[model samples]
Target: MKKLIEVDHVSNERVSNVHFSLMEGSLTTIIGPSGAGKSSLLLLLNRLEDPDKGEIHFKGKKISDFPISELRRNIGMVFQQAHLFDGTVEENLKFGPSLRKKWEQNDGVKLLEKVQLSEEFLTKEVENLSGGEQQRVAFARTLANNPEVLLLDEVTSALDMRTVELMEELLHKLVKEEGKTILMITHDLKQAKRLGSYTLFMNEGKVEEQGETASLFQHPKTAALKHFFEG
Candidate 1:
């Protein structure tokens, strides 16, 4: 397909000169050590934090050229924590679209079902749910926009393995069938390999190496890769 996101020498003072290109209709994993700027790079796509000197383009249009509302709606982001407001689950889902965020209840619920959550949870209070449930709700909320590009920041890092599996299955579907572009930051290489077809192995805020998931993990290119897998 086309290039959905083009990040060239993307450097915010907080981050480093990270260079990468995420293709359209594909799932690309951003893996690296702590403070490697995986999450920072995710934020840059929507200009959550501007790059000191670099350019980001989405669908051949400069990200800087997009209006805030238009840009955010097209690029949905899920943070490390499940940040649900103190309200019923449905309210949280509704809130995003109600505020003119790009979303459709029908399509969003389909995505939610993949995450293994029922529509019944919609009426339940968000705060009462467990961590896994909260993350599921968060996933539904993120899909509220039906974004072309989904930015996931270690979304399952806090959940247990079972919860992680559910989230992984949902993400896998998004990448494979839904044809949505995804840029995910992950600490777990197992999760990365399972969910991402492409991989960008980063270290100290730069891409040390990148390739297909199986090849990169099976015959890792750098010493950093060796240390990362060993540790």
Candidate 2:
């Protein structure tokens, strides 16, 4: 697996001295308490915010070298809340691609199906959907741009257990079948262990531990990580 994203000595107001690499076709989970810079990291990755110090490289090139539009299109992000516009699902799905002039008539249905939504969802108003449905729509909307990576921020935190489980399944399918590289922030320890091939443990805006999920969970090398798991 080639390195898809490399964060080298990155620092910002919320995080400090951070470094990590995400492999292509991998699903890596970032887990920690509030103020751990988990969300901050994602912001930098897609250039929603740039790091005050250090650099982020994607696919062996400096991220800053790419046009902002192309950078964001390839590194799509979905926030904790579904930030959809007041429109039908098809319209929302078409929003990104249409802005880039890449929209095709069949794009809405294809994007919906990728996120496990049916073709019928294309015509439905987004406001009429449930929370879980809306989140899936948001995911599908991001997919409309055909990003190489997906950054997820506690996307299932507000959902029911069953819906969370189903969302987890969808994420797995995205990585395993659709070949997306994902970096997810999750408050659920069990979900992190279940979904992430690799896990990054952060504390005080720094990466305290990172490794294969099974090893990181079973043999935490730092006291903060051990306490995190214990508590």
Candidate 3:
């Protein structure tokens, strides 16, 4: 597979000398304890926060070379808390694409279906929806941008188990059918193992270990990783 984003010695106040490549159309889970900089690392991916040192390349081109607006449009982010605007679900879905003059009449409906929500949700008030439904709307809104890569920061942390499972299923479908690349930060190791093909284990702002999820979980190479699994 082609490399989508390449990180070389990237660092910030919270994230340290991290190096990795996210392959196209792959879901890579970043797992670590709290304050290990998992969320900090994700911020740098979409230029939500820039690395104080090192470089990030998108599709073999320097990330800085791309316009920030366009870059963020291509790389969408979904946070743990779904922050919806004070409006209907359709308005939330149309927000991003409208800014770029790419909004379509049916975009909202299409995105809702993609996230496994029905058409009726389009007219529902975002604030009236349950947490899970709101999150699904958030995902659909992000998808409306037609992003190539998605940066998910503990998106399912506040969700119920069933909602989390549904989100995982939707994510897998997105990867398989749409070939969207995903880099997700998840504290749940079990969720990582279930959804991720590759996993990055981090600690104290550094990458402790990384490899295929099955191999790394089955045979942790470092004491830290072993302890994490054992714990």
* Ten contiguous residues minimizing lDDT sum, candidate 2: 108-117
Quantify how close model 2 is to the true structure by its C-alpha RMSD in Å: 1.1
Check candidate 3 and list the clashing pairs. none
After superposition, the stretches of candidate 3 with alpha carbons farther than 4 Å from their true spots are none
Give lDDT for model 1.
0.83
For 1-231, candidate 1 gives per-residue lDDT tens digits of 777788887777656777778888889998989988788888888678889887888888889889987798789998998889988887777766878754565754565576788767777898899988998888788787678899999999999989888778778788789889999999988889888889999888788889988899999979998899899
Question: Alpha carbon lDDT of residue 38, candidate 2?
Answer: 96
Per-residue lDDT over 45-93 for candidate 2, one digit per residue giving the tens place of the 0 to 100 score: 9999999999999999999999999999999999999999998999999
The order of the candidates by TM-score, greatest first, is 3, 2, 1
RMSD of each: 1.9, 1.1, 1.0
Q: Give per-model TM-scores.
A: 0.93, 0.97, 0.97
Instruction: Tell me the tens digit of each residue's lDDT in model 3 across 1-231.
Output: 999999999999998999999999999999988899988888888898999999999999989999998999899999888899998999899999999788888888889888788999999999899998998898888888889999998989888989898899999998999999999999898999999999999999998899999999899999999888877
